[model samples]
Target: MNVEYKRKFTAVVTALALVGIGVVLLGRDRVNAAGSGSITGTVKLTGTPPHMRGIDMSKDPYCVKQHENNPAKMENVVVSSDGGLQNVVLYISEGLSAGEVSAVPSEEPTVDQHNCMYSPHVVAMDVSQKFKVTTSDQTTHNIHPLPAPGSGNIGWNKSQPPGAPPIETNWKAPEAISVKCNIHPWMHGWQVVVKGPYAVTDEKGNFTIKNIPPGSYTVTAWQEEYGTQTAKVTVAAGQPGKADFTFKAK
Candidate 1:
């Protein structure tokens, strides 16, 4: 090969190698960004779980029909067969700075009333994020959310008739608000207001809070009936953290 052609070929090969290196570095950055660490654990009941009281929907014919074949039970404390506690809200109660905290999701989280019961017994969301309250029941229902005073969240009451549009709202502060249906005294649920990422335990009592920036944090698990428990957790980038909790039955 001519000297000039050989020089050009070497330069082209070097440029190609540099481009490949750049591509690999870019991919690594993308992976690191997408590989934020997560916290996961299971909540268990250390003692005997209380028996859930049976709910009576005889007053409202619609509710009665909705649960005629499958009666509903109080969800104050839901326990799995293996003693795992369900519906517990697990969240990073502290340690995130303003910049590290995620912004409120544009999409609203929903609390659905279905079959004379709240679809999810417990719901959690970031403060100031839009929230939706909806009902699929044929009966007219009044939703009353009672946030504790001094929590900076204003409490409100509104009626949602059958097929009514979802009620959009937001909590200005962080608080675990209790929600109830005045029309159906037995209907109850919780709206957990938080400043950062949170998770609710499933029927199996497992929970996972994802996309958390690496840091030392105070993780809390809250149960409507059993109260709240806290634990310290240290998370590293691209590594999973574990924070298990156990609530003793009262």
Candidate 2:
């Protein structure tokens, strides 16, 4: 029975090896959150808010009905009552090591088409991170992502009819890709693809990028309309770093 024992021993060794590999991958996605730090801050919009362009959804009866209570308008610069900004993307721009930059999140971000408008006006993603596009409206929509020429991102335009399956995909490079719908000319959004951990500002202009290792970093905030702003901060283990920013409405 010596040969039978040897075979069983080999099988156990192989199984252990596979488990080790699995742990490594799991660690990358979870990043040992217990030992990691986070960056938190608020983004404010100073000065008077710009007059957003009104959207004419008369072309689609379904779209028009969806916004009967509240009219549609351009989301280029949406500000809260307290002057907080919405849809601002924040990410670790400098001081991240190669390993951190390559730590693509396992979580998937989704952009939904609702009421003939993009639910969230801006989406931030890490390079190679998979995201989804979904349609919630009754009308058909053609998603057109326009990345700059030679930016290493191939652009694609696809149509999604009502109740269509979600379109899942990922980007290979970092760039601010503009997303539009051919069917709805007033529809506009953005995919700010970057490297490393990122966060998007909420309606109150608050954000927090989690799972960052304790260290000093240069944080960058990007607003589609007013450009970008940067700041330096230090994160401590189990504690959070803070960096607040304000942009004038030009």
Candidate 3:
């Protein structure tokens, strides 16, 4: 009788322990689900895109050879055959709380130099978020960023030779910083830094800005050539809000 009672008590304790753990896990899942939201949209061009002039890489034979198969062209106004606008930076221009404004992304964005052109043509990042500048060319290139004065974001220019290490850094303020390679005059790109969550439009103009808390925000979409457009959106917990924008070609 005594042995049987002890066995019963042990079984009961084991079951209770399992139940307690299950409850904790369920609470954690619920808290995570309630914490954040997302915003999704597409950016399109309404009118016909102006003809982008072909880049002349004759000054650097290495750059010319890199683009021998597929010639390089200006990316000032890249529009897909379906009117999808690429290289546009969309961010929360307003309506962010103090906590949200301080939340910077951990993932690093990259601006790669391939075939004497900046891949993606434009890079968007949150303020104080680290980004990398890498090169895939055999020739030496300079990384020069021209930030506007009094913007609190100082300017820097560094030389990146063949097989050199990546230049890792972050911006201090929100601005569209223009980047260029002095060696290759045709090389041009933009590093758009803004506060809070942001996303860059893909080739199809699709974008999704994640980790946004529940609130109404003023979202802005900026294209290097067409300028900026803003829209208002409201996000709910665990739900994705939608806002699309169209930039008319001038």
Candidate 4:
């Protein structure tokens, strides 16, 4: 073959490879609600469960009506007496582009104080996002942040009363911030200050994140008591990948 022809052939091959990679990357991230990848699996326990502590189901005036005499299970804090899993935070680790990120901040995410309980146990929001702290019931509640972890947190306090205007606050921290009501000590919840979109698992230990770009990622699962767990996952075009997490109580 002629030298010029050989060089031209090599150039075409390299261009095709590059295009193929780009197509693959694009295909992976375009599934549904966002993309073509998937992350689904179970989060099971790994060790001895931690004895329940610091939770008073009886403390929340609103809970007594629903769970009489039963020890209050902290929201999203899964406890399996048979060594089951708890608190898993699975997320995409790689093959994602911030340019196409859809986990945008809502103009208003309401956090209501009802029956002295924080409605959503785990709330996810973007940094610098606006979220309302409102009270729907007659009780007075305060949103207390447990100092942003790793940012040398100085517990910040805000008071919200029923009939009063909602408090507009920006989450300046990058990590998850634990919020509680000092007045109602048993009132507990969490705010996930995420850069992108995320969700917390429910009581049955199930989670699903949609619209991920197909590729490899390190999905992370986190629990208040169990710390953080991560696993490697690969997603294909228009397909959901099963990515489960496990956390054994220590």
On the 0 to 100 scale, the lDDT of residue 158 in model 1 is 97
TM-scores of all predicted structures? 0.87, 0.86, 0.88, 0.69
Q: lDDT of all predictions, in order shown?
A: 0.88, 0.92, 0.90, 0.66
lDDT at residue 9 of model 4 (Cα atoms): 96
* CA deviation > 4 Å runs, candidate 2: 1-35
List the candidate 1 regions with Cα displacement exceeding 4 Å: 1-31
Instruction: Write down the worst ten-residue block by lDDT for model 3.
Output: 28-37
Q: Give the range of the ten consecutive residues with the poorest summed lDDT in model 1.
A: 99-108
**Backbone clash pairs in model 1 (N, Cα, C under 3 Å; residues 3+ apart or in different chains), count:** 0
Report the C-alpha lDDT of model 3 over 22-132, residue by residue, as the tens digit.
Answer: 899988866675356889999999887999999889999998898889888899988888988888999988888888788888999999988888986899999999999
> What tens digits encode model 1's per-residue C-alpha lDDT throughout 138-208?
99989999999888989999999999999998899888899999999999899999887888899989999
User: Which residue pairs show collisions in model 2?
Assistant: none
Backbone clashes under 3 angstroms, per model:
0, 0, 0, 22
Tell me the tens digit of each residue's lDDT in model 2 across 106-195: 999999999999978898899999999999888999999999999999999999999999999999999999999988889999999999
The CA lDDT at 124 in model 2 is 88
Question: What is the TM-score (0 to 1) of candidate 2?
Answer: 0.86
Error of 2 at 34 (Å): 7.8
Per-residue alpha-carbon lDDT of model 4 for 86-167, expressed as tens digits?
A: 4445555455687544356465666777666676666666666778777876666788979655664356788877677888
Off by more than 4 A, model 3: 1-30, 34-36
